[model samples]
Target chain A: AQTVTQSQPEMSVQEAETVTLSCTYDTSESDYYLFWYKQPPSRQMILVIRQEAYKQQNATENRFSVNFQKAAKSFSLKISDSQLGDAAMYFCAYGRGGSEKLVFGKGTKLTVNP
Target chain B: GAGVSQSPSNKVTEKGKDVELRCDPISGHTALYWYRQRLGQGLEFLIYFQGNSAPDKSGLPSDRFSAERTGESVSTLTIQRTQQEDSAVYLCASSPTGYRNQPQHFGDGTRLSIL
Candidate 1:
């Protein structure tokens, strides 16, 4: 069984600053995918970023980037130039290459102060 | 629909009542998933359906909870004699099949409250 862990329960960052949310997982599979999902007050789960275990290069999406260390089983989300709209519950998830289900970690609530 | 849509944005039913939550996935998606999210908790995978394959009910909490998808378009999660523990937001997501890198698109979710 694969399990994701988000050590931080809550985090806050000032507007225009940077925030890094930590995530780690335990999986025996060699091929898998990692994802970060955001859920605002509206309760819609939106995909933030994705990282393929086979890819050595980190994935970047504009202000959102991931530091993926496959050997350490660590995948952290870095949000640069944070805005108020970035305040939400961020969840770290893991899925195997051939699996249809995703294992999610307890979310970390992020609050951006203006 | 332009995105995944869930019906009954909010549902309040007494304990012991049965409730049905609907999910309509994106037109071209071949995989649909059902999950439960309690307040301040992460997503709990409930069931999964892919194309015409047998649905995975391994994640379901109990026999009271069952789900079915008609063809590849829509799905319904039915909870019989709902309990207080069943009170949570039911979320639905869809993804493109055979694409390992595809991300799942989600609906806002249906919040079920048991009184």
Candidate 2:
């Protein structure tokens, strides 16, 4: 079974600063997908970014990006110019290709200090 | 535009009572999923439905938990004789297809509280 691990239980960053949330996974499959999801106080899970294991280039979305090191099985999310709205619980998820189930990490609570 | 819809944003029920949670997927989405999020924890996959294929019940924790979907439409998750342990936020999501590249859009989960 594939498993995702987020070592940081909580993280804090000042506004306009940068922060990285670390994530690692264990998977035997060569092709898989990794994702970072943010959950606000409203209880809605929002997709922050994603990376495909087969792709060598890291994925970037606006201020959010991921450093995907496939060989190390490490996928970390970096948030630049963070804002107060970015404060939330972030979760890392992994799913193998052709599989419908996604395994999630415990989660990292991010706090943006203004 | 509207996203996935889930009814009764909050549900408080007694132990041993049966409760049904509803989820209306985005129109035309071929895949729908159910997950449970305990407080301060990550989401846990519960069940999945894709197109007309047989639903996947592998993630279901026990026989007490069951779910149903109607031809790429609404899905209902039922918890029979619920236990306090069953209390958690039940979330529903949908994607254009069950493809790996497509990310799942989620609904504000229904917080189920067992009293």
Candidate 3:
């Protein structure tokens, strides 16, 4: 069985600043994928970033980046130049190479304070 | 149409009644998924449909819950004898392929409320 854990239930960062959300997962599969998703109040879940287990370099999408430590099974999201629009529920997810589904964490509520 | 589309953005039904939720995956997508998100909780995988393969119902919570997809195009999740606990946001997602690297595009979700 695989599980994703987001230790921070809630996180806040000043606008234009940076914040890091922690995530850890337990999986036996050597080949997998990790993702960060943001769900705004509109209810649309948007993919923030993704990291492939085989890759040694972390993934970055504009202001969003991930510190993927495969050995420790830790995938954290770092939001640089955070904006008010970044306020939402962030979820960490894992998907094994051949699996059809993604295992998601409980989620972290992020607030961008001005 | 554009992106994954889910009908009836909000549904309010009475307990014991049966309800059907619909999902329209993005064009050319080969995989579709169904998930449930309880209030203040993360999304829980319910079922998966990939191309012509048999649907995966392993994540389904109970016998009352079932889903069907027509060759990866559209999917409908039907919950029979709905209980209060069934009141939650039902979300649908689709991806270009079922591969691990493909990111799933999600719908706004149907907020189901059982009265």
Q: What DockQ would you assign to candidate 1? A: 0.73
A1-114 per-residue lDDT for model 1 (tens digits):
889999999999999999999999999999899999999999999999999999999999999999999989999999999999999999999999988788999999999999
**Candidate 2: where is the Cα deviation over 4 Å?**
none
Clashing pairs in 1: none
Q: Residue A86, candidate 1: how far off, in angstroms?
A: 0.5
Please, what are the lDDT tens digits per residue for candidate 2 over residues A39-102? 9999889999988888899999999999998889999999999999999999999988998778
As for lDDT, the candidate ahead, 1 or 2, is 1
Q: Arrange candidates, best DockQ first.
A: 3, 2, 1
Candidate 3 local lDDT, residue A23: 99
TM-scores for chain A, candidates in order?
0.99, 0.98, 0.99
- Docking tier of model 2: it is medium
Kindly report which residue pairs in candidate 3 clash with one another: none
Tell me the whole-model lDDT of each prediction, alpha carbons only: 0.95, 0.94, 0.94
C-alpha DockQ for predicted model 3 = 0.82
How many angstroms is residue A63 displaced in model 3 relative to the true structure, after the best TM-score fit? 0.9
Tens-place lDDT per residue, model 3, A3-114, is: 9999999999999999999999999999999999999999899999989899999999999999999889999999999999999999999999989799999999999999
